[model samples]
Target: MTHIAVLGSTNMDLVAFVEKAPQRGETVTGREFRTIPGGKGANQAVAAARAGATVSMIGAVGNDSFGARLRSTLEHSGVETDHLRTTEGSSGTAHIVVDDHGGNAIVVIPGANGTVDHLVPGDEGLIATADALLLQLEIPLAAVLAGAQAARAHGVRTILTPAPAQPLLPELLAATDLLLPNEHEAAALTGRTDPRSAALALLERVPQVVVTLGAEGSLYATRDAEPVTVPAPRVTALDTTGAGDTFAGTLAVAITEGRPMPEALAWAAAAASLSVQRAGASESMPYRPEIEARYTS
Candidate 1:
């Protein structure tokens, strides 16, 4: 089994589904309200586990009912939560609004996730044993940096998802083996809207970069070769919340299993395509067999 370590945030998602979002200072009703377990970190961990990786999650949650549900969700998805800590306050939460067309807007409350400013003693040991360490910006930057440094010290691959895009410090970039960002994030980071140009620019900071283009698939770039745009299977999307997470997690699993970059991107795309046809984050992710069937079909 492929061992993957994730050191990040865990949150309870409060979602509202509607035909269209309300304007500022205006009130509108939604079709339904639901709560789900998600946080970029938790979602990615669940994605990797569902893709057949033996995933160990290292993060913090609050001592609340939502936190309990979040923990149980990961455990149910086959993720090892031995290092998941529970703090004395509310768990992190994302106030999400999903439009009928599958687009979404979200507001994240840090809660316990903000408290994880740095790693505890056992965190490094957990990262050292993994094939790759999956990280996101939902948690504190200091903790993200510490996780990256530890992974570097242990010679473990570090895959950083620069989500909720923000300025990246130089030290963190040096420790990163792969940087994954969506097209908008790439443009925000590099000031380049064209995926190829943006990807090439990112390569100067990290050894490799993958820019996800939604239905257009993903662009892969490395210092050693020219960039390639892998195409995604065309499919109607119902919800795109977990699509990127599914892609990143499945890509990590594929790489660990020794698939070439091109083949791995294809597998990841297939997995993500399956996700968009469903609803909710984590719940939308496809399993290993499902991904294989989609890829082969």
Candidate 2:
């Protein structure tokens, strides 16, 4: 199995299902409420492990019930959490509101995740052993940069998902082997609304880019390679909370296993399609056999 390393955040997702999202300064009634173990970091780790990669997570949680649940959830999903730290405070939390149409809006409060500003000793060694390193912006930008630098030095392929989109530094972009951003994120990163143009704008900073267009598909681009578009499998989406993370994790695993880009994107799309059919974050990801069966069928 491909050894994948993820350096990111872990949060407890407090989700409320409602008929529709609340408008500005409006209070809306919700039908149900639940807490799920999540965080872009944890979600991707679980997704990759379920997709058959040997995944290790390097992140911090808080000394709280949510933290315990998050760690246990990752363990149950077959992720190695030896480097998961527990701080003496509240765990990170994401307040999410899901509409009847499966659309979601989220607000994140970084608690322990904010504390992960630097890599502790031995963290670099862990990155060195991985076939690929996955990172997200949910954690401190300093830590993300450190992880990317370590991966680059160790000759490990580095995939960066710039979520909760923010302005990225040139140094961070230079260290990224692949940049995966959703359409909105791509627009924020490159200041271009057109997916193809946005991707082209990003290539000037990173060598490779994948712009995810939810429901429609995804577009892939590399410096010397022709751009390719992969259509997503049609499915009735119940919840799309972790679909992008699922796609990124499966794509990273497939690439680490030496699958070609097109095939890997296809596999990722299939896995994401399955994830959207369910609810929650990590809980929605499908296993390797399930993904394979979906693809073969």
Candidate 3:
């Protein structure tokens, strides 16, 4: 199996289902509330593991109940958490509001996630061994850069998902092997609304880029190859919280397994389509067999 190392955040997602998001200072009745083990790091690790990759995580949780649950959840999903640290402060939490249409607005309190600014001892060795290193921006930028640099040094492919989009340094973009950004994130990164133009703009920074266009599918660009579009599998979405993470994780595994880019992208899109039909973050990712079945069905 291909090995994947993920360096990012771990948060417990506190979700509330409402008919519509509340306006400023206007209280609206919600239908339900639930807590799910999430965080972009944990979600991608779980998704890759379920998609048949040997996965490991490098991140920080808190010395709180949410941290404990999050750790257990990752362990249960078959992610190696030996590098998962526990800080003295509160665990990270993502306060999310999901409306009836499956759209969501989220506010994240960094908490312990803010403390992961440096890599722990032995983390460099792990990065060297992995076939691919997955990363997100939920954690501190310094740590993400450290991991990306280490992966680049070892000739490991570094896949970066710039989520919760922020202005990134050119050095970070240069170290990335594959830059995965959703439509909104792509726009945020390039200040371009068209996905293709955004992807082209990003290619100036990284050799490869994939712009995910929610339901329309994904667009891919490489230095020499012409850009191509891969249409998403149509599915009635129940929730879209982890769909991008699912796509990223699945893409990593498929690429590591040596599948062609177009085939790998189709496989990833199928997995994400399945994920959106379900509800939670990590809980929504489908297993390899499920994805294979769906793709062939």
- The per-prediction tally of clashing pairs is 0, 0, 0
Candidate 1 global lDDT:
0.93
**lDDT scores in order:** 0.93, 0.95, 0.94
Candidate 3: residue 6 Cα off by (Å): 0.2
Q: Tens digit of lDDT per residue, candidate 2, span 1-297? A: 899999999999999999999999999999999999999999999999999999999999999999999999999999999999999999999999999899999999999999999999889999999999999999999999999999999999999999989999888999999999999999998889999999998999999999999998899999998889999889999999999999999999999999999899989999999999998999999999999998777
What is the C-alpha lDDT profile of model 1 across 143-168, one tens digit per residue? 99999999999999999999889999
RMSD of each: 0.8, 0.7, 0.7
lDDT of 3: 0.94
TM-score of each: 0.99, 0.99, 0.99
Off by over 4 Å in 2: none
Alpha-carbon error at 255 in model 1, in Å? 0.8
Off by over 4 Å in 1: none
lDDT of 2 at 148: 98
